[model samples]
Target chain A: MKKLFFLIGMTFFFSSCEKEGVLTKGSNPIPTINNTAVLKYSGTFVPTSGITVQGNVNIYAQGNKYQLQIENITITDGPDLKVYLSKSDTPSSFVNLGNFKGNGTSVYDIPAQVDVSEYPYVLIHCQQYNHLFAIAELISKQSN
Target chain B: MKNKLKKALLFSTLFILGYTANAQGCSDAGFCSVGNTFKDAQSEIKNSIEIGGVYGVGEEDVTVFSPYAIYTRIFTNRFAMSAKLTATTANGSFGTISNLGDVFVTGNYKFNTGDYDKSKWSGILGVKIPLTASNDKINNFSLPMPYQSSLGTFDVITGLDLAIKKWEFSTAVQIPLNQNKNSYLSQLAPTDKFDSTNLLERKSDVLFRATYKIKTENQKFIFRPNVLFIYHLGKDSFENVFGQRQTIQNSEGLTINGNLITSYRLSEKNYIEASIATPFVVREVRPDGLTRAFTIGLSYKRNF
Candidate 1:
């Protein structure tokens, strides 16, 4: 009986160990730009203090709706990364676009309720750890 | 013998606590086991205490361990009351979380049938109260419902059970009193493939179960095979980031499960039971996070 109990205990101990998920590079191809689409804001990605990042970010006005696009991007891989449109360089008071599709061109649909003028910074952030990887300060292409 | 029983009870409790396992996919929302649903009908005990543990794997390979205790008091031959407390711990790629799950208080009233040996009928009423807020978070990001310990709603449960010789049939309904404050949006973690449970308003669930019992010649062992069906009355809804209520498509449907229970009498006042359940059919979307691939449990019951 003791040996049986020991075996059961060992089986549970081994089975209870959590399996870690492997993070793989993901891709989201850029969408085709229509004639109705107009460039509203553009920015270039800048790495945070110790992070490496390079990309061009653009916000396009398609009729009343808006779309944010990241092109030719490369960044340090991390867990639970998210794309956010923030009012400031920091992630506080932000509209989450979605999870970051690693190292590629991706387009995210901005909610109609979100006003681009109010959120001037596009941020790449690790949502799980609350760490900022890169920031892009949006410059108004219409104003230029 | 008394000392041996005490030691056995202590050992079982310790084993359950240390197992770190998971629980059922009945999708009951707290009504299926309300009042004498799975109790032994022939036992003459007026009161009893039960300790049990269940283990299962849910969506996204999330492992869940649920340990529960139940206390019952029979006021008369016709009336009885029971209270159950459950605690849950979930571990997965997201993280590990532990919390008190829910509490259920239920009453059962057996009605006199013309012939007691031929048939018996009982009415059940119960209430479920959430112990956790159902909004547990990790690093400010809200964990999905799979990680939540409770469904986070006050619910009213009503049911009826009828027993005829070796066959029993029961039907029950659970209605949530209010929406939960959970703010987990799966879109924020798209790779996880979890559904949004943000400010979720769940629909009511109706359950029906049929069981057949078989007893050994010596009456020392009993076996029960049960079939359970649950249907969501309507589509559940959740709040979007834009503060709009959106219905989770295909969230309203039916789930059918097959369960087998075996019980052994250790003595006049002691019994041990083991059960296993697997789904035969499942809904397309289980945003509530009660989707279990399978479940197995063991319990010890002491009667007085």
Candidate 2:
């Protein structure tokens, strides 16, 4: 046991610099959305808008027994969209909207009364700068 | 009263010892490195910063400097026992940092992190080594330093921690118990010995630590933010210098502070780390005279 610990320690010591991710994405989705693509959706859609367009996508996340669902989103002129959720929205720092590989419609089933009161709206911001692009509103409340 | 305190501690011990005698340590390394969530077989924190800063209350002109060394021994899958030995070097009298150089050995067992991570839960039992250094800066920084020391000090530490992803949260308390009253009486004044009935008497410390970090895969660049908190009371709180009321330590209430530690792994054997600590909330007065500074140092790890 001691020998094994020594070997592991030696490896870690020699390889501290060679290591990569400080934290691994626990579980990732398929066809992940390019953070930039999502940020392009502005509530007010227009042709010559500086940001690109991708509209009406579903969002979902189920950690343990809790479930969250974002029905649909629309793009406007710019990449930043603004939507105000109903009074009952639980804001969460680690929110998972659905996957967005190329671009298509996505849906998520929300549990009956999962408490998502914190993050009332989802800010689809550029992944790089994390700038707020599109804002989402919560209209329905449910539990599973 | 002393017996009651002793019995209280002993009962707590038996309840823990009796139930866990058969249980073993946790998975991975021991105690899960209170500052970090990951565990490795061959482990050495080498040097991890205490992320939080401290804000002191009560008294004034009180300043202190203390450094600590702690180690955890993994016993089994569900629990780990540990010990901490520290040396406190003070800069001023009473009003500032009070407790110094307390050598204590404690046993700790963990509980949570049920399935995913098992290193978070922990219960502690330990003792502090006492000293009668009258010249103690905290008591009388002007008097010189304490050479007369007490060998045995019964202290207790109870703590728990939870780590998820990039964050860690924990709280702990250290209480001094059992004593060599004769030891103090022999060196100082007769009335100076243990107050006898004051089992909960004398000195005790309470602290909290929390940290968040982002590490690179190559282990090259790592940044961690943390906080440290301390609360002192009893003989540990009072420092009398040559019949003069020198200072009133961290006796007031709570002190909150934070630290940012950036470490770069230069090579397999040599790593450089810089820690910058800040005092966020000052309950009483502004922090002065001290570094309010950054600690930059290098550490070498060798598997021998």
TM-score for all models, in order of appearance: 0.67, 0.38
Model 1 over residues B126-191: C-alpha lDDT tens digits? 899998668766543567898787898999899999988888899989999988867688665535
10 residues in a row with least lDDT, candidate 2 chain B: B23-32
Write model 2 residue lDDT over B199-253, tens digit each, in one string.
1124454667787878889878888877766544443222121112223343335
Give Cα-based local distance difference scores for all models. 0.77, 0.36
Q: Which pairs clash in the backbone of model 1?
A: B21-B65, B22-B54, B22-B55, B22-B64, B22-B65
C-alpha positional error of residue A46 in candidate 2 after TM-score superposition, expressed in Å: 99
Query: What DockQ would you assign to candidate 2?
Result: 0.00
lDDT of 2 by residue, A1-144 (tens): 355345434432332121111111223232333333212111221222255554543333333232322224334432111222222222224233212122333323223343444444444433212234444453233343
DockQ of each: 0.06, 0.00
Model 1 error, position B220 (Å):
1.3
Off by over 4 Å in 2: A1-144, B1-100, B112-120, B131-154, B178-203, B231-250, B265-273, B283-304
Candidate 1: residue B277 lDDT (0-100): 74
- Give, for candidate 1 chain B, the lowest lDDT window spanning 10 residues: B15-24
